[model samples]
Target: MATRQTLIEFIGERYPEIFALALDHMQITGLAVLLAILLGVPVGIWITRNKKLARYIIGTANIFQTLPSLALFGLVIPFMGVGLKPAVFVLFLYALLPIIKNTYIGIESIDPAAIEAGRGMGMKNHEILFLVEIPLALPVIMGGIRISTVINIGTATIASLIGAGGLGDFIFKGISMYNNNYLLAGAIPTALLALGVDGLLGLFEYKITPKGLKLARS
Candidate 1:
């Protein structure tokens, strides 16, 4: 009970700082995921047209996925230097594989007969893509985005080390000073943010998914 009260008091004292840090964390995460979606979705679609390139592209993204987050951050430091740019860039890299792979899988998994029906209806390639393919593929693509967003939220804490200034500042400070309140202050919010974003995205995924797909799943 005493510890709980202490934590509450600590949060009360540091509310402004915590709010600002949370905003910064969200900004970094949002930008990284947006960039990933923009680039990844297009590349994912493009690779579908080129199976040979798909292998190389997905393989390269897999390599980035395999790298430790800290190592990737360290590698970018010399070229991009410290702060938000590098942090976002690293997070973007981390986000790419899931978005790209899921998109590929999503589109590729569509029945060939569906594409033939669209073509039979005299739909152009782009029309078929936008109408049939994307709608069907959306849930899977959103799954990747949801995965990426959660990963970014958690990883953004480490960005504080590069002067990116997120909840991680509190976490690392807590570690250095051995302050449990500080650790809780940072860790709790990060976890909450991840869970909250994931839930919201899950809802959005359901809403955007074609009704037929939902029925099929059911």
Candidate 2:
């Protein structure tokens, strides 16, 4: 009973500080994922317009995916320096592959017949893309975004190493001090944040998926 009370007191005492860390974690991750979507989706669309280039562009992003996260952060440090700038850049790179690949796949997967039908109706290329292709592809693209965001939540913890504070501050401090409560305090919240984002995105995915596609798949 006394131990339980102590634990409660411990969390209550640090709740404000921990909450601040969580907000930092969310802010950094949200910014990175947003940038990735903005940049990556366009790149994906452009690359698909040239099949020869798609392979090389996607190949390069694949290389970044294979690199160790810490090493990638280290690589960016010289150019971006420490703190939020470097951290956001590294996470942005980390997010690119999924968004790019998914966007490409989503767009490419559309039926040629459907595209032909659009052309027959006098739809311009851009019109077909915006009206037909993108709507159909959105679910897949959003899945990638969801995946990347969840990944960023966990990865953002490492940003603390570069002096970009987040929940990892608690994690590293706990590790250094051998405090289990502090460790759980950070780890639990991070996990919860990831799960929450995943769930919310999943709901959005369901909402946005085209009705015909949903029926076809069903």
Candidate 3:
């Protein structure tokens, strides 16, 4: 279509800006993801040790999920100021639940018999937790990352509202100008980014799965 060519030309003309936008999205998403992992991994380990706390941990994350993204973003602005910092913080907060919950569930769901076998072989608790349990849990944990990344991509569109500048810039610009083309530019790229990242993570998950486990699944 003529519209498609025009859009491509527009993007090519602004390729650097588009690349920057993508990088900004990646930075915001990656920062959030990294922080979530730091927080989630430890909490997941702690939950394994204190079964009673698992409910509370998951319950707290669920509470965050219930709040609207806009509302959560608004709440953080007062303490964190505005723009990319606050936006990244919001994304990080949003990611925490999935990563933490999946991390805990993945480790917990791992076969107890395998864990016993490790212990029976005289492996220390830390050794078993890191060596045996984590390997088995990698797939599930990566699933959480996939989820969080997709969510971040969609949510990053709102980043421009706070001056964080991303693909959302196109969507928001289109809105102001009432230009359908601009909105499509933003929406399409963000959607593609989400899908692309999801596929990559899915591949990573498959690769990390143990060879023996692959047969078991089959």
Candidate 4:
């Protein structure tokens, strides 16, 4: 049984390695979310313009979301054979649904009058979408991104199963070694990472939202 001092000592000795794994975890999560946003947001926009395509694409994203994260990683292992590539790919898929769904909802929920006003000003479809619609919808879109990113941080911990090392490496090691301290070392940092990232994104969400909308809602 590891005592308090023992746990502290373990963490102290392993600090460098733990920090590296944490960085790896963040890198993987960040890259996966970035990729999902790049791909998912555009798809969401494209589909919203076509009901049939929206149904199919959003349905597919929903299906991907339904799968277990580990199971998805397992499925990818054969093709990518473990490490950052497969882990990022699986996380990217997991991150896509929220972003895609939110983007669709955000754009669709825009006031018709606002859209018409843009049109009345002689704005083209693409111009109105870029200048007017997207600005109004940014908060909702950012909210979805926040949700996806927080989820990815937690899920990235499991990437160690495929040797895609992260804080989960400490967790699995502790589990295998039956050392509570090891588990704490991994679990605590992972929790902190999730909370920190979520808070930062929340701030971004607030900042991006139009102040006029905030006042109107208030």
**Candidate of highest lDDT:** 1
Q: After superposition, which runs of candidate 1 have C-alpha atoms over 4 Å from their true positions?
A: none
Candidate 2 segments whose C-alpha is farther than 4 A from its true place: 1-8
Q: Model 2, residue 140: what's the lDDT?
A: 88
- Candidate-wise lDDT, in order: 0.95, 0.92, 0.86, 0.91
After TM-score superposition, the amount by which residue 181's alpha carbon in candidate 2 deviates from its true location, in angstroms, is 1.0
RMSD of 3: 1.4
Candidate 1 — worst ten consecutive residues by lDDT sum?
204-213
Deviation in angstroms for 184 in model 3?
Answer: 1.5
- Tens-place lDDT per residue, model 4, 60-91, is 98998899988999998889999999999999
For candidate 2, lDDT tens digit of each residue in 17-109? 999999999988999999999999999999889889999999998898899999998998888889998999989988999999999999999
lDDT of 4: 0.91
Enumerate residue pairs that collide in model 4: none
- Each prediction's TM-score versus the true structure: 0.98, 0.95, 0.94, 0.94
Least lDDT summed over 10 consecutive residues: which range in candidate 3? Answer: 10-19
lDDT of 1 by residue, 117-193 (tens): 99999999999999999998998899999999999999999999999999999999999999999999999999999
Pick by lDDT: 1 or 2, better one: 1
| RMSD score of candidate 1 (Å) | 0.9
Cα RMSD (Å) per model? 0.9, 1.6, 1.4, 1.7
Candidate 4 lDDT trough over 10 residues, lowest sum: 209-218
Task: List residue ranges in candidate 3 displaced over 4 A.
Answer: none
Candidate 3 lDDT over 119-207, as tens digits, reads 99999999998889988888888888889889988998887888888888989898999987778778888888899989988888888
Error of 3 at 8 (Å): 2.7
